[model samples]
Target chain A: MNTHIRVAPGDLFGDGVFETIHLRPDGPWLLHEHLARLVRSAAILGLPEPDLSELPAFTGEDIAVPGVDPGSDVPRALRIIYTGGRVHTAVTPIPPAVLRERRDGVRVITADLGVSVRRRPPWSISSAKSLSYAENFAARRWAVRQGADDMIWFATEGYALEAPTASVVWLAGGELCTVPPAEAGILPGITAAHLLSLAPSVGLRAAERMVTLDELVAADAIWLASSLRGLAEVTELDGKPRPHSPWTPRLLTLLGFPATS
Target chain B: MNTHIRVAPGDLFGDGVFETIHLRPDGPWLLHEHLARLVRSAAILGLPEPDLSELPAFTGEDIAVPGVDPGSDVPRALRIIYTGGRVHTAVTPIPPAVLRERRDGVRVITADLGVSVRRRPPWSISSAKSLSYAENFAARRWAVRQGADDMIWFATEGYALEAPTASVVWLAGGELCTVPPAEAGILPGITAAHLLSLAPSVGLRAAERMVTLDELVAADAIWLASSLRGLAEVTELDGKPRPHSPWTPRLLTLLGFPATS
Candidate 1:
C-alpha cells in the first residue's frame, strides 16, 4: 500500500533494523517471536531499546484503510521499522507474487556470494535483518533478469548459506534440515525455526547441517521458507528441472497454511 | 544539523542512492558531477530517472536555521537523497569530527572484507553509493572499538579494495595512485578523481593501480578520500607507526582544502 510518514533525514542511512510479520485475523502470527527478533536485530545495529509494548494495543480501528477491512481474515504484512530517529509500523497488503510462489513453485539458482563465512568482519551485520537491503533487492532483480524466480547464496567454502530473504530448507533421508544461522553467519529465519519445531509433530526428524551446493542439489526436496511465502519449493535448480515434491502439501498443512492452488 | 522530512514507508528500506556534496560560499562543490553520479546510482538500483533540476535553486535563505546567519560563509553539507518514493535534499552543518580528521589525520586498521572482486555477483551494487551504509558505519565502529579512527578493506585475494565509506589512495615513487573503480568493483570517488586531475599541476603523476595490502603498507603515505572528509591520512595502520607525511599539506593545498588545524 502507498503510505507516507515523516522521518528524520538521519533515518534514511540504513542504520536501523526491521521485522516483517505475517498478520492473521486472530492477530499477528508469531507476534512475540517477531518482536523479540526485532529487538535482537536492533541491538546488532547498536540502536537504543525500542518500546514494543505499545504494539498489541493497535487494533484495526487505529489504522484507517480506504477499502481494507482490517478485521477481515485476509492475510496482511505488518512491518515494524526502528532507527535512531524513531519507531514506525506499516501494514501493507501481501504482494500477489508471494502468493503465486507459494501456490506454484519457484525456479531457483545458486550463486557464490563471494563472502567467507569464517572471516566475516568483526562488526559484520550479516546476522541482522538491517534496513540496508539494497543488495538483497538487487540480487533478486538479477535473478529475474536471468529467468529465475529466486537465488540461494553459497559461501566461498562451497557451503550453502541462505536465500536473500528466506532460509534454505531441504529434506534428505526422512530428515528435515536447515543451515545453522550462527555457523553460517546468516540471519536466523523465524518461520524456518517454527517449522522445524513442528517437524516432530508430523513424525519427522529435524536437523541443522552445513551442506555443499552439490549435496543440496542431491536432496530429495528443497524449499525456501519465510514469513510471507510460507514455503516455495525449488522446482528447478540452476537449469535442471525437478519433479514436484509429495511432502509440499503435508508440510503446508502442518504449518497451518492453506494450500489451495 | 538535525532536519525532518516527509518520507514514504518504502523510503526507509534503504533501496535508494545519495550524494553528499561540500557546500562552499560560492556554491555546491562539483554540483554537476555529483548529480550525474546520482543518476548513475539510481540506474544501478533500477530506479527511474530523478528530476534534480530544482535543486540548484535552493539558497540557504530558503531554509530556516536558528542561531546562524544564512548570509555567512560557513561551510555546510548538501545531502541529496533519492529513493523510490521521492527526492529529498538537506543542508546540515559539517560534523566537527570530519574537520578533525582532515586536520590531524586518522588512525586506521586493515581487515579482510570477505568479498572477492573476481566473484562479485552480477548485480553487485558496490559501484553505486546506495543507501546501504550500515556496513560502512559498523566497520568504523569496529575500528573505534579497536582504538583506531577508521578501517580499510582488503579482498580475500589480498588486494586492497577500498574503505567502507571512502576510496584508498597513496603516494609511491613520485606518483599519486588509487584503485581503479571499475576494475576493483568499487564506487568511483569523486574527490579522488578530481584530486588526480590536479596531480600534474602539483608536479606529481596520476595513475590507477591495484596494490596488495603489503604494498600499501610500504607506500610513502596513505589516505582515505571522500566528499566530506576530503582526505584523511593514515597516521597509524594496524598498530604500526607511520610518521606524518610531508605531502599531506601540499596535497590539501592542491585540493583547495585548508591545512590549518
Candidate 2:
C-alpha cells in the first residue's frame, strides 16, 4: 500500500525505532505486542513513547481489493516507523528470498561482535530494536562475505548473543531454549518468547539460558527466529554441515506461519 | 540549498559514509584533503570509493542568486553523503550556535566509551566517518543531558579517544597533538591534521600520542575541531572548570578561522 509523509532531512539520521508485523487474513498478527515493544524501544532511545490510539486507521477494505484472487493467499507485512516527528505505517509483499530461506533454511556463521557485555554505555540501546541498523547491515554483509547467508554475533566473553536480525533458539534434550535477553543484553525477541510460551502444549520444555558456541553447536536443532522470516533453520554453521531436523516444519506450522517454498 | 533526489526506502538505513566541509569565499576549504579522507573512510567501511568526478557541479552562478544578500558575510557548510547507490551534495548556511561555540568555546565532559582498544573488530570501520551515527548523536544527547555541550570518549584501556562528531586536539608543552587514528581506532580528523601540519610554521611541535583522561584534562588547551564548528574550546571537562587558554585564539587564527564571538 502507498503511504506518504513529510519529514525534515535530519529525520533520516536513524535515531528512531520500528516494528515489522506479519499481516494475515485474520488480521495483523500480534500487533499489540509489536506496538508495546515499539514504545519500549523508543524509551530506550530517550524518545517519547508513540501514541497508537490516534494512529491513522488502515481498514481491511484499504488492503483487500475486488479484483484480487481469492484462491491465492495474500500475505502482507506491516511496518511502523517512529522518528522524532513522524509515525508512519506501510504495507508490502513478503520478499521472495525471505520465503526461500524459510523453505530451504539458511547457512549461518558465528563471529565475535567485539562489544563488551559488561561495559554497555549508559545510553546503550542494545536491548531495544532501534532503527540505527547500519551495524546490523554491516554484520550481515560480513557474513555474506564469509560465504554464509547470515551471522550469529557473540559477546567478547564468548557467549552467543543473538543474530543481526533474529533471536537464537535451540532445542536440547527436549527443551526449547533461547537467550535470556536481560542477562545477555540483547533485544527481547517477541517471536521467540511467544514460541516458548507455547512449548508446553507441544510436549517440550522452554528455557532462557546463556549459551556458549560449543553448547549451541551441540544442540539437537537450531533456528534463527524473527517476526517476518518466522523461523529459518540453521542448515549449516561456520562451514560445517548440520543434519536436517524434522522439527523445522512442525514448529513453523505451530506458529501459524505458512510453510512456503 | 533545497536539493532533492529520488531514493529507495532502503537507502535510509545509514549504511554509508559522509563528510561536512566548510565552504569559504575562496571555495570549499581543504577540498582535496576532504575528498581523500572520504575515499579512505569508504575503504574502512568496505564501500566502493565514490567517484568524485560525478559530484554535482558547483559553480559560482549556482550559489549566486538575485534578492539573496551576498554581503551577509555568512559562511556556507557543504555536505557530501555517499550511499551504495548514490553520492549527493548540498550547501547550507552554518547555524549561529555552531559559530558561537567556535568563538566562545564549549563546556566538555569526558566519559569511558567502553570499547577495547586492542580488540578491534576484524571488519572494524571505526576509522571511517560512516553514516551509522545514531550512537554519535546519542553521545551528544548524553552530554546535553549531563549539562555539558559535548563529550570526549575514552577507550576502555584508559586512552582518550575522539569526540562523537569532532576530533580531539590539545596543546602540551608547545607540542600540538591528537590521538593517532590507526592506533586508537578512530576516524582521523582532517581539520585536526591540517592544523597540525601548519603548526611548524608557528614554531610549534606536532605529534600523535596515546593520552589518558588525566593528561587530556591537564593539557595546555583542548578543543573539539571539525569543519562546521571550526574549534570549540573545552572550558570545562567533567564539570571541572579550566582557565581560559591563550592558545585557543591563536590556533583559530592559524587555521584561518574566526577567533572571537
lDDT score for residue B126 of model 1: 92
Each model's DockQ score: 0.85, 0.47
Model 2 spans with C-alpha error above 4 angstroms: A1-6, A64-75, B3-6, B64-71
Which regions of candidate 1 are displaced past 4 Å? Answer: A56-66, B58-67
- Candidate 1, residue A125: CA error in Å? 0.5
- List model 1 lDDT by residue over A181-229, tens digit each: 9999999999899999999998889999999988898999999999999
Model 2, range A1-261, lDDT digits (tens) per residue? Answer: 444334444555667788888877766788888889999988888887787876655556555423455345656677788875557766666788778788888999998887878888776778887777777877787888989999999988899999999999999999999999998889999999999998998899999999999999999999999988899999999999899888898899989987754
What TM-score would you report for chain A in candidate 2? 0.94
**lDDT, candidate 2, B31-101, per-residue tens:** 88888888887776677778888875555545532345765666777787777656777666778889989
Alpha carbon lDDT of residue B125, candidate 2? 76
What TM-score, computed on C-alpha atoms, does each candidate reach? 0.96, 0.93
lDDT of each: 0.87, 0.82
Model 1: lDDT of residue B170: 98
